[model samples]
Structure formats: structure tokens, C-alpha cells
Target: METLIKKNQAEKQLGLGILIVVIGSVFLLRNSGIDIPRWILSWHTIMLGAGLWIGYRRNFQGGGWLALTIIGAIFTLKHIVVFDFELSRITTALVLIALGLYVILKPKKVTTFKNYGQANQSDFKDLNS
Candidate 1:
């Protein structure tokens, strides 16, 4: 348990450090008259960063971060590349697929009910017999 906690802490710290470096680099480049793309500084990019940070912090166990990351990437791509079809439709389809995959592939929890004050599995088995 201690090792797991330490690992999570380390991941969080590393994520924070990377975020700081990226933000600083963006600012430095902008200040140096490097024509940075508008999309790179937009809210979509922020969403992407936030999603990545959340995923890293949580060790990519859940779907919230994945959803955010997908949305951000799709929107960012929209800005960079032109698409003939509707972006909303594509986004919705992709999000649904991701959610379905997560639901189907995520680990299932094993629940064991202990008999402290109530009847146990053995009681049910005897009743059946």
C-alpha cells in the first residue's frame, strides 16, 4: 500500500513538472516572436492538457480523462484539418465507442459477502439440499 501511494505521488509530481515545462515553453516561444498556431493556445488544447494530467494522476484507470482527451483531440483536429462531415456526429460516435469499450474491458470487482450478523453462503447451500 505504501509503495502504491508513493508511485501515485511520483506520477502526480512528474505530470505537474511536465505541465509546467510545456506551459513555460509555450510562453517563451510566443514571447520570442515564434508564430505559434492559434489552436495550440486555444481551450481545446487546455482540455487536452487537463485530460492528460488527470489520466496520469489516476494511472489511466477511469474513462473521464479518456473522454476529455478524445474531445480535445477531435476539436483540435477540426481546427487543423478540414472535414466534410459534421464534427459533432463524429465526436458523438467516437465517445460512445470509447465508453462502450471501457465498459466491456474494465476489470470486474469480485464481491464476497462475509457472515457477521447474517446468514452465509453455506446456509443457502444447506437450504437447497
Candidate 2:
């Protein structure tokens, strides 16, 4: 889980750097008639991506990434996207709720864990015995 956090941080930093470059390029080269800048989703996309990445990285067994993603969506992607309260918000809310319920109720698919710590096989056997 600690390694997962580090990976998330690395990905977030990389995403942020890419975002900065994208914004800079868009602004600096605006007069050149290139239209690719319209796709950047700012903080919403960045944070949302981070949440999703972290969640998947840590296997989403039990954590707060969904909450983070929702908050990110509200803060970052809210104004950026066209808000259709009836269609988009309600549907998304229901979907998220369902996903959360499923995550909570369903059994974990795999229970095995790979320990990469310094403890040797003898130490593990001793502990188990």
C-alpha cells in the first residue's frame, strides 16, 4: 500500500507536468491555428485520473478513492463539462452508488498476498508455526 501511494504520487506528478506543458503550448501557440488545446480538462481530469489510478493500483478492496473521484469531479470537471442535472448527474450518482455497494458486498477475488519485505521464508515459517 505504501508503494501504491508512491506510484500514485509519481503518476500525479507526471500528469501535472504534462498538463502544464499542454496548457503552456496551448497559450503560447494559440496564434498558430492549432486546435488541440480544447481537450485539456484541467484539475478535474488530473485529480480524477489520480483517484482512479490509485484505486486500481491498490485494488479498490476498501478505500476512499471513489470519494476522492467524486470530489474531484465536482470541483474540477463540474464547470468544464456541460451539466445535465437530470441525465448526467443522476445517472452517475446511481452508478457510483451501485459500484460502491458491489465493492462492499462482493468477496475479494484473490486472497493471496506477495510479501516483498526483508523477512525470509524461515522467519515466515517460524511465525506461522
Candidate 3:
């Protein structure tokens, strides 16, 4: 339990440090007369970094936030280079297909109920009596 607490604290510290570095670098770039786009400097980037950090901190127990981070980063790539929207569309389609295949190929669990008929008959007889 103590080790877990320490690990959580370490993660928090690491996240904060990363946040500071990102913010500092943006400011540094601005001070150096680099014309960063408004969108790149917006809250969206911050949120994406936060989501990625949180996902990592939690060891990716749930994939929702991590997925959002990935998608958001992919979209943001357009700002850095020429990313065609068609690429994102293709990625989405591929993800859907992978999910469908996983669902189809995954094993199903079958539950068995033993002596259920006997239990029901006894209960029915008791009620009738």
C-alpha cells in the first residue's frame, strides 16, 4: 500500500514536470519570434497532453483517454506537416474493422446452471401445497 502511494505521487510529480516543460517551451518559442499557430497553442494541446499523462499514470487500465490522445494528436499532426484528412478516415475505418474482427474472434463464455429444474419443481410443489 505504501509503495502504491509512492508510485502515485511519483506519477503526479512526473506529470507536473512534463506540463511545466511543455508550457515553458511554448513560451520560449514565442519569445524567440517563432510564429506558432493559434491552434497549436490552444487548450486542445494541453488537454491532449494531460490525457496522455493521466493514461500513462494509470498504466492504461482504461483505453478511452489514451485513444482520445492518439486521435487528437493525429489530427494535430496537420499543423506540423501536410496530413491529408483521408488518412484519418482510413485510420477510423481500420479501427472499426479491427474491433469487429476482435468481437467475432473472441471466445464466448457459457454459463451452466446445475439442478435448476429440481429446484424449480420443489418450489412449485411447495407453492401448490
Instruction: Give the best candidate by TM-score.
Output: 1
lDDT of 3 at 26: 81
Candidate 1: residue 110 Cα off by (Å)? 10
User: How would you order the candidates by TM-score, starting with the best?
Assistant: 1, 3, 2
Q: 1-129, model 1: which lDDT tens digit per residue?
A: 999999978977887898789889988999999988788889998998789878866778787898788879788766663445645546667667877887888778867766655654245776687
> All candidates' TM-scores?
0.58, 0.41, 0.53
What order do candidates take by lDDT, descending? Answer: 1, 3, 2
What is the TM-score of candidate 3? 0.53
Off by over 4 Å in 3: 78-80, 83-129
Backbone clashes (count) for model 3 = 0
Q: Going through the candidates in order, what is the number of backbone clashes in each?
A: 0, 0, 0
In the order shown, the candidates' Cα RMSDs to the true structure are 5.9, 9.1, 6.3
Query: Candidate 2's C-alpha lDDT?
Result: 0.65
- In terms of lDDT, which candidate is strongest? 1
TM-score of model 1 (CA atoms): 0.58
